[model samples]
Target: MAEHVLEMKNVTMQFGGVVAVNDLSLEVNKGEIVSLIGPNGAGKTTAFNVVTGVYAPTNGAVYFNGKHIVENYPRGKMKKLYAGTSRGVYTKHIEPTPDVITKLGIARTFQNIRLWKSQTVFTNVLIAKHMRRTSNIFTATFRLNRKEEKKQREETEELLKILGLYEVRDELCTSLPYGLQRRLEIARALATNPSLLLLDEPAAGMNPQETAELTDFIRKIRDDFHLTVFMIEHHMDLVMDISDRIYVLNFGALIAQGTPEEIQKNPKVISAYLGEQE
Candidate 1:
């Protein structure tokens, strides 16, 4: 059996009266490029936020590499507002911060470009390595972490060179063209040494050519680094061309999931994206 790198078991995220993700369950196996695609406000990003610890799920659990990273049961005032299918299934609560999630081999990029505008391209990537640093603040402040710091810098330089950003390492992050900025964000995520990379709309603002290049880049990274990719994308061309499997969402609920060929022919997916015919 394939080892599941990530799994969501009856996961639900609710806010007051709104159920953002309702009993959503899915899994991405090791070394697979799985996609979650859907229409606007389908709760895709909400599910991503739930996985990365940005939000505590109202019900159910999330497992990463066979370990439970997030598990919760709705309680308190939420009991009255909870409208999900699985409310009492989760008996324990486990909510870690986003940084903690990153340390556990998960890294993500936002739907919007979030590069540090003031920093250089190189600095942006280097900062992501801080999460894995073993030295204490005192050692870092006193420059006693020279060995570790040097190692990190060396790794950063190699990563930039490999990702084709070495030439513009000193360029201001915001000054780069939109495509490069997106690449930089992904590169920063890679610097965190993540085994699982979650990209939210990686091709959001790209032209066809750039999107095509991104398709190749994603496959290259997944193969070269032995990483599992879970992305939320709307670009059907990219999703169809590159994904090992695809899951479709509607109204925060999973509507369909299968291989790209299967999804392309799924009537429910067609209805969700194109609406009913007269």
Candidate 2:
């Protein structure tokens, strides 16, 4: 059996009185491509946000690699204002920061392209490498650590080449085609050297041909990087073609989960799609 990299147990989130997610539980094993599919307001992105620490779950727990990540930080004004709270009181339970999460082996891309629009393609990726670099900016600015700088540059160039962005490395990100821009975002995420990658709607605006190519590209990257991939995508064909497992969400809850073939035949999925047949 493959090792589980992430686990969510009875996770629920409520915005005031309305529940966004209800007792959601899922797992992604190592080296697997898992796709989360749901209707527009199924709380898919909210689930991602909870897992990535953008929002704390109102109830339940989240575990990554066997460590409990839920409640890593204290909540409420008492904790924030340091009103009689001891320093390091929550230190033992504190989860690592987002940067630490990336460093510890998880990385993600947003639904929208979040690239450095004015920067060169290479620079966009280079910025992600900043997290992994050991040298201080002062040393880099003064050229005091030429070796570390050269190493980082080499790493960036290699990532560009791997993602097929080397030819356009000098171009401004905003000037690239929409497809290339998406690829750049994935490349930037890869630059973090994550063991698990989260991609959000990677084929949102691409033409069919571009989406087809993206399917292959995602597969190749998975194999090459040896990373576990969990994505939320609306493109059914892409999701069915690439994912090893599929999780179906509807109205902020998981309705079905199985192999692609199994999910394709699920009545819940059919109903969720409102009887849209493949």
**lDDT of each prediction vs. the true structure?**
0.96, 0.84
RMSD of 2: 5.5
Candidate 1 lowest-lDDT run of ten: 81-90
**TM-score of each candidate structure, all chains considered together:** 0.99, 0.88
Clashing pairs in 1: none
Write candidate 1's Cα lDDT for 159-200 as tens digits: 999999999999999999999999999999999999999999
Q: Largest lDDT belongs to which candidate? A: 1
Error of 2 at 78 (Å): 15
**lDDT accuracy of residue 256 in candidate 2:** 99
* Candidate 2 wrong stretches, greater than 4 Å: 72-96, 137-142, 275-278
